[model samples]
Target chain A: MEKILPIGEYIEKGINSLEQNLSFLWSAIDDGISWLVENMNDLFLAIPFVIILALIAFIAYYVKAGNKMFTLSGLKKAYGLTIFVILGLLLIYAMGYWEEAIQTTTLVIVSTIIALILGIPFGIWSAKSNTADTVIRPILDFMQTMPAFVYLIPAIFFFSVGNTPGVIATVIFSLPPSVRLTNLGIRNVPGDVIEAGRAFGANENQILYKIQLPLAMPTILAGINQVILLALSMVVIASMVGAKGLGSIVYQGIQQNDIAKGFESGLGIVVLAMILDRITQSIGSKK
Target chain B: MADDNNIRIKVEDLTLIFGKRKKEALELLNQGYSKTDILKKTKCTVGVNKASFEIKKGEIFVIMGLSGSGKSTLIRCLNRLNDPTDGRVYFKEHDITRDSNKQLLDTRRTEMSMVFQKFGLLPHRTILENAAFGLEIRGEPKEQRDEKGMKALKTVGLEGYEDQYPAELSGGMQQRVGLARALANDTDVLLMDEAFSALDPLIKSDMQDELLQIQNKLHKTIVFITHDLDEAMKVGDRIAIMKDGVVEQIGTAEEILTDPATEYVEAFVEKVDRKTIITAETLMFDNPIIVRFKKDGPKAAIRKMREAGVNVLPVEDNDEKFLGYVWLEDMLKLEKEKAKTVESALNTEVPSVYKHYTVEEMLPLITGHHHPLAVVDDEGKLEGIITQTSLIIESTRFDDKEMDKLIGEANEL
Candidate 1:
């Protein structure tokens, strides 16, 4: 209020100069992200509806197999999960939002993959080094606490409004929980257990993968579950940047006062969330 | 029984300081500063001092002490789990302390394996997978490693529980899986850091006996760490007693029990019941007076007993065969009856014990003996005699000065 520093103007000038100076690097990143999102979207849409449903059933059945013994009760839960997956898909199709559902699912998945690729290594680095942890922790805190709407402004400037920019914003918003949870999981591994690995002559790499990662897996899977939920929650907000999907349909509903349209697409998103949540939560709880 | 020439592991002046300023602490430690004094000055914890000892091949060398004495740190350093700040460790002839990553990896894979106090089994892994972990890390084929792991599981008496996760098993059974992991590695040296300490006492003892049974067949060089003196005494061929990051004494269990080198060691030895430490070998007097069998008849037996100033003499045949004891009264009576051989005069009722028997086992026999209880070898040849006086002397062999000091300290306590 006193205008002691004029921090906002200073940040604006700094960002302006950064944009001009690093335009080439930004373009390269923008192109790479565009290619990845386009191909992933195509891959998600190209699969037949029947194949997608069967694939979901396969994944659900496989994951459920780990949770149960050879008893009838166990098979009942497994079959229940598979049937639930089929019902959810049919509900989306019957609502006539099946294609939009696929696009939104692809968007959520692509953003999550990119976020994970970046987050997991960063998490491992933070877990391993005090310096990295000190630096990453505050950045993670800032990313998590910032208003989700604030991401779209920077997203538009970086890649201009589209599904690509929308995904970029979603990844940034979803990244922290993945990194934080992964770090916590690795850090929480018992010191004696790691020492036991070392005593048996496991190399640093072997220890990381064979001992640490496997032990840290359940916690990491929990992180992935959070990432999926966060990515899905970003869908409508992303649609505000002209990303096409069920979020755009919801956005159209909000604009023209079409209650039925908003409710249908919102229901479609809910169906997706429930299905994804159940599968990912199952993976985490199986251990 | 440990041979000096067949050393398996030689640890020399090994030291570990835990803190950011370890270099300064180690320097101060070398300059005659105590661990506490150095800690005060540099804020570094001395995990292991300038500790040193050798382990013989096929021997169970135990590092034993109270908590915070650095026994665990010392054992961990042997395998570089807790890296030493100074000194060298040799497995056979290779200096493991300075081994490169590849060399260290090779050494750990092929030459040594470790078992941990808390089991350290992977919770997600089945018992079989946990048992094969060491070999798996070394990149052995699954089939071969699994076969070896199964054998090790059988050896530890956990053969049928292979598919169960470690958490599903009882703690003792889980520890058996841990042991199976080490044994499956098939390495010559085993570093066990308080391996059986977490088990219930009965299971702990059972595991201890099981370890010895496995040791008998495998004869691997084992370095066991424990704070429990009974466990140490029961398993160790030789023990290094540690106190405050320094090794106070290293000796056989008997030597540590009978001749503790420091006051700290004496304090620990004080708690030990003497019967467990003093064996028949310790109590027996070697080469007691005896009458020669074929050459010495009942007449000569009586003369030998009289001259030796004993009521009884152990009679041995020419080949050192134990022919029982000949009592002076019996020999005299037999001589009067014109008995020609010492065999005729020998009582043949003398109770005998093997040299390996503990003094506790010979207490009843020695209490009412007419003569010292004969200590015989497995061949039944008399090796020595355990007199009641000798048993008492050996059992209460503590120095009077030390006992007085201990009593004075106890009063203070």
Candidate 2:
């Protein structure tokens, strides 16, 4: 009877664990879907920014090509300038809704900066040491594949809700790509180039600065671009934890059934996105 | 100790093995396994094997081999770019292999500069900035760096294009920018690994000429690596031909051409035209008659020729020396009323070309002229004679049939 009771208790504990896990997963999905729906308007706002920036860069490229200048002219210059103008316009528009947009931008920017600072070093370390790569890679995979809202609950429990928690959640969401790309870039730098630099009497720092980094710039920039876009995507979802900005505006639009407001904010967000994308692309092309 | 004209680099028995299990691979290779079999068995590769050479100050030494012959690997090993597994390399008697990383860095930054096959120009920097990079890294002031960089750019003939990016330039121009970058460092030693191989033939020739010009002026001790024999002949003071990670021969162009030490060396020089390689200096006879002619005379020429103890005499009509002939033959024929002109009696005439004419150019003339051709100075005075006998003796020594016959006779014994 005693052994049977122990077996019964074990079964009960297993059932309890299963139920808890299932409930946690369900809540995570529910939160993610609702957050995405609420932020649809902010996503729309970011779209125009993206378009405007891309258009500017394209114009700059065209102008440069038309003038027969090897450097930027014609459409290329126009494209770059247009992108800059659109970004400026987005910032100005955000000023009207200043406090909220500023809060969201700050959350996004701080998280991105943290992610970059932490991610790049970690990535380079992993690339340099095989043991570190093996250890960190699985963790990176988990961070990347886990649901965004699932991160918020744990992040909230650790740091609690508000800007800090929001920033933490965004960092967790945006950090993986930066790490992966940094590793890939550093590792992909041609072996001969490194040797050539060494033969030229380049020390470790010189090799990294002159040979590896310059050669790896395109890949590193690409990673940063990915992180930026990912951070922007996470902004509105972060609003659930008291983060503000165009995200809050979108959330209010949804709650009140104000379609016009939703569309306007969505258009603004698009413009911001376009601007970021174009500038990054230009930097990449130049490198 | 720091004289500009001393041996700059000496490498002895340099060997580089890649992968941790190189010994096992080498053992397998020794056991009559193919490269693939060895690789499968031990997963190691040998890059350079016991290579040895020396680079004299101000001399352009070329190391030439086909791909995988270890020429590139050997050059890399010189700067410790790829550390040799065995052997010692000395730079002016300092053992570079034992130098600390800081010392190596200092040596590389100030004493030696390298140019890569791919150019390896930093794409993000302008040509000027790229050229100035080493100076920048060494903490030189921007103004000084810029001045030096501009000077380098001018040296490479890209004076006006300093602001342009590497991508904006053609391949040849990009390579020039690379050259400028190396030159800007003002290093004592320059190592070039197939620097001109990537360019078009015409551009390659131009670059070779440019390199020769630079070497002549700077007197930089250079170790250049190439696969092209013609380029090696043109630029190298001495050439080391490598095969299967071993040097087949190392000597001056004339030595290699005149006396290849090994069958492999002979095979390498076999297809090259010899005439273009042998100079008049190699072909000239030791002694010849010197004569002065006051006028065009058959009798006075005979007297001068007898006094000089030679059949032929050069006819100097003022300061200018004309063709030589047998004065006795001319006088006797004239005395017998059967005389032809001195020009008709002269066996051969040699035209004065530049002093560097190779053996290949002289061979055909020696064969076709039917008599020894006179070697002449730029002033048209006869230097000496380049005879067919000397050419044949120099050439047939490397003939395979002679070697095979000697071996056959030895085997019979």
- Cα lDDT tens digits, model 1, B101-127, are 889888888899999888888887889
Off by over 4 Å in 1: A21-58, A65-71, A79-87, B1-5, B291-311, B316-322, B326-346, B364-369, B378-381, B392-413
> Whole-model lDDT for model 2 versus the true structure?
0.74
- List lDDT for all candidates, in order: 0.87, 0.74
lDDT per residue, candidate 2, A1-287, as tens digits?
44645875685677567556676764564455335434643554556555644555455455334444455444455555555655556564654653455445555666778799999999888877899999999999988888888767655654446555576778888999888998899899877667756766677777877778777878988898888888888877787776667776777788889997777666656656665666566566653
Give the DockQ-based CAPRI class for model 2: acceptable
Per-candidate TM equals: 0.88, 0.75
Residue A224, candidate 1: how far off, in angstroms? 0.8
lDDT accuracy of residue A230 in candidate 2? 87
